[model samples]
Target: MSLARIYRGGLPSSKFIDVALGQGARLLIRRSSDRGIRGLMGRQSERRWIRMGHNLIQAGKAKRGRGMHTSGETDMQGKAKRGRGWAIALSVLAAAAVLGFGGYHLWLHRDVRVYVNGVPVDIRYRSSFGEICDEAGVVPEAGDLYSIAGNLIATGGGGPFTVSLDGVELSEAQLDAVEVEGGESFTVRDGDDAVEDSEVVERITAPRLVPAERLAAVTYVSQWGANGIDRVRVGAVSGEEILEEVVQEPRDCVLASVNPVPSDGRRLVCLTFDDGPSPYTAQVLQILEEKGACATFFVLGSNVGPWSDAIQGLEAAGCEVMSHTMNHRNHYATTSDETYRETADAFAALRDCAGVYTSVIRPPYGNWNEHCWISSRGTMSASVIWNVDSRDWELPGADAIVENCTSGIENGDIILLHDGGGDRSQDIEALPRIIDILREQGFELVTLSELMDADDRIPDEAARQYAPMPEDCAWPAQIAE
Candidate 1:
């Protein structure tokens, strides 16, 4: 074999002789003409090499004349003999040295080397990598790496994680064919070339409540779903980019926060303006437009024409424009004649201007007394009363109005506010916040008729229906008026 092939084995001849074959075999290398081999030998090794050369020369001469030499061919024979004799001698010695020391024992008792992830470990020689690992108190589990000599023990994460011995991948049976014996290197790694090469990122999308539409038009938020880790899965694994996707499916979670309703059910809330379609009505409508909320405008007969544009706009934009009494008359016995005209005229004005009719009316002072109820009975379908009162009429600060309206709100609650009646800046300011708060609390803002008709409830049962005469027929009516 070529000297290059011998060098490729990684164990130098001189070093092997010193470690395994002892001082006797080192003389074979020292006699070599190669500069590298001669430079490696010490003075004592070189002296021993000179003595071995003399013995080989004597042995070569004895073999030269085994047959008789002719005097005529003597000179040519002499030239050939001089060159070939020593070459044959040295070649024999070198081959023997190589074969003899290839399996020689190392008895010098030095620290053997083991490497992991480029970090060296110094240990006594062990027969196999497993033996070295056991001696060093390292035992590999399923995912850990084990290499005997250069062969990797089979370990895969149920995928293509390859372990190679000098670039040849081996199975568990193939790994057993190797031995650690002495110094050898092994590597442990998690391979994901397939994953890394692809540009897909696994991620979890947030869970959101998809409220399916219903026929009842009244339902509360049942599940306020939460955000999740990825689209199909949660956390990311190593070698995964986690940018936009995952392969594994995640558990679908159901988190309920409110009472159950039909899948398509929509909760109803009334945003009622008691006396509106005024200058301030424009501001209220603008707030509604911005918030995407609809309301019921209780239009007064007195302001309908002058405030027609604002009132018509409210009706156009999906609002309920119904009657509030004309001239703001109280529901009283003395004012019964005037109350009837005011209520009737207000309803007429709303119908004439907006081309829509309302069966709902808000009695002045929210009172349904004997005079007002009797006056409005057939003409009015139902008397709309409030469950959530902002009391902006009291000129309470906008914050107070917001709190009053938002507090204790329930499904189908009518929130009473005004776009008229007085300086309505507080009302205007509070309206948007009221809508937001109710929406955040999961209430859907709708018109009065919608609220009354929600959940398939009867209008009379859902609304604050037209009042009957007081128990005394006069006393409570007087108090209410």
Candidate 2:
């Protein structure tokens, strides 16, 4: 056969040589290649391989001229040439096998290298990009960058690695594939290309509540309610951002109702100002407002017409405005008929002058005797009498007034201070001081109704009726036992 035909299809010359030598030669070549024949060969052995190759080429030429020989001569020459050709072919085959085996062994143990953030990491196995990083102790993060390799292996986080080859961006499939070559480098750096996207999310916020002890089934919104917002950023790494805005901070709404008991279980006190709607009344209201306190104002009926705004201010300031009898009439000196007239007229004047209606009354000089009680049976809920008196009507100094009001004060005690009937400058000065002192002592200064309701003193029948003696109610002439 022609040499070109033998070498067709790019099959190695040794392959044909093995076929000519039969199966035994093929197996020998394979075994030698598997065991690494190069490790056994020296320079002299290499020189012998070169000589064998030259003889094999010459044998090919001799075979091409074989037809020119005479028949008898051809037989004799053919046997000798064939024997020599076989020897040369076997030598060449052996050298080629050893060389091929060496090349394959070198390929199996080839190193894959990459630079990780300026550090060199060497990987021995042909694993996926992610596995190679693991083997080399390299973990690329979300904000980290990767490039220079067309086929990038994913990190431990399993990603389509941001990859480029020769400055050209690669497809997602190539970026995610397991491909690494020796001496290839990639850097893990602070990259600006980390995908950053945002979404707005709304969250419902519950309104805060502050419970106030009261008899009414009502809720007062001291502050309005609103929802809250937050912004979330999504990327290689997830994070939450709390935006600073003009957010209306939630405030507590005073929820007034009958509770089982106080959370602190502390008894409350009622601060009552008698004969008010006075010149100092506004000052006292301002002090109460500043101190965040509530009190009861027992207004004189005669003063209501002249100081109608002051009386209304008392109600507006969350203070309970009640009656202190018309013209400050002494209940003890008045006859039963006169006592009824005084009590009923004062309530009528309060309702007329200031639209004020309350069930509590402070008897003139707290003198609610049988005559007064019999005359004003249904007109009042309770005769609020003070146990702790500031005696500021005597024009005591502000210090003395504060001392007298705060001392000997017990829970459930009613404190008395007049805002009118005299110069109440001391009373006004002492009001805020007394408030702070009482708060420090942990006494909640409530109105008369709140204190009585807390003590369960208001009868269920009286509680059922609205304040100011509902117009439909009839007064009994007999005294209550």
Candidate 3:
């Protein structure tokens, strides 16, 4: 039998011992204090023996009997096995710590970003690059290239693109120029990489400028130009760009005022008679008829009842019959209700006389206040006033009436005269002479309505015609009776 050898485990000062011999090369052993046994094996050999002894111990093979007596070896073997298990546990813990730290670093610095026209975009927080571009008003189209930080990210070939966090894109490149068409926007990325790799996002575009065609022909009323002559930039939107040197002017035509004559290019004059339907109205109508002219007759409501036939004859002769109030009351001193009543009565009288409703209304003495408009509730007829006063009401002589009307008859003039306030014999006598003089001077006598109507600049021949009144001459009884 061979004696069993034993070696201590771990560190210096380890012990070695020998035990009793047994049969069949097995060792029966107990602790021995032999100092020489320690020296028998070198350090490396002792380590190897400790390893083998430990493996046997764990396998439950270390025993005293038929095999080698290995009590000393068994104790040393048990210690070595325990030490190996502790080393394995420490290695596993270190590996786990490294993996946990790496995972935390990846979570802390993650972000998605976008850019436009070299400008950083932060529209929707936590949104994908494509979603940010949509919010930034970016459109995709051909020949429009987009990049971020010198990397070409997207090539616009006139196709739609879907953006996502994981989408891959081209590298970043310097943007030399960027333009958008039809109010579209393009997406820009940090570099040519997938959306996940992008560090920043932006939208790129140029500011839109108003076209010259939009402001081409802006027509404006000049405070200094001739009456009714608006300073218009013809072809501003479509025509010429340099504004035609303000050379094109509008004809002289009356618009809203007493004599609103458009001063486009031609001269115009309006002749109006107030307090009419007296014997003078017929003479005035005859003169206008002979000269192919027209005039407005502001007839008193009472006068219409007596001279309805004559007024109708004047209307048929192309004259406009407007209201001068039932009693010619001073409108400035009248109440709101009185003004409405007076106006309504005058309208009723005129309609009774002419067998048709009249739209023209003139306040007596040109006396009107803001209340007159407000009280009527936007239904009171338009009030006509005069720009040129012939002072025919003052019994101006025939020569004076002609001079007064012609003197101020510029491009647009509404001349005022009386026809029926007491004896308008002077007006009757002066009308024919005035017509003759105006015709010779190339002045066309038009009603106030006609003069104002021409301000629209449409030719009279092209103007729409209204239906003429029936010959029955039946006034609606409710209006008159």
- Number of the predicted model whose TM-score against the real structure is largest: 2
lDDT, each prediction: 0.56, 0.61, 0.51
| Model 2 / residue 223 / CA error / Å | 39
> Which scores higher on lDDT, 1 or 2?
2
Best by the lDDT measure: 2
Which candidate, 1 or 3, would have the higher lDDT against the true structure?
Answer: 1
Candidate 3, overall lDDT?
0.51
What ranking emerges by TM-score with the best candidate at the front? 2, 3, 1
lDDT of 2 by residue, 13-115 (tens): 5445434434333444446543334343434444455555555656655664764566867666765666565665666666775576567667656776766
C-alpha positional error of residue 102 in candidate 1 after TM-score superposition, expressed in Å? 99
Q: Between the candidate structures 2 and 3, which one is better when assessed by lDDT?
A: 2
* Model 1, position 325: C-alpha lDDT score: 68
Better of 1 and 2 by TM-score: 2
lDDT of 3 by residue, 324-440 (tens): 878888878888788778877877787766674664566788875444544433233345677778887777677787788777456666778877787777777777777777767
lDDT of 1 by residue, 323-418 (tens): 776767667644566666777777777667756566457677766543454444235544556666787888989999999999987666677788
* TM-score for each model: 0.40, 0.43, 0.42
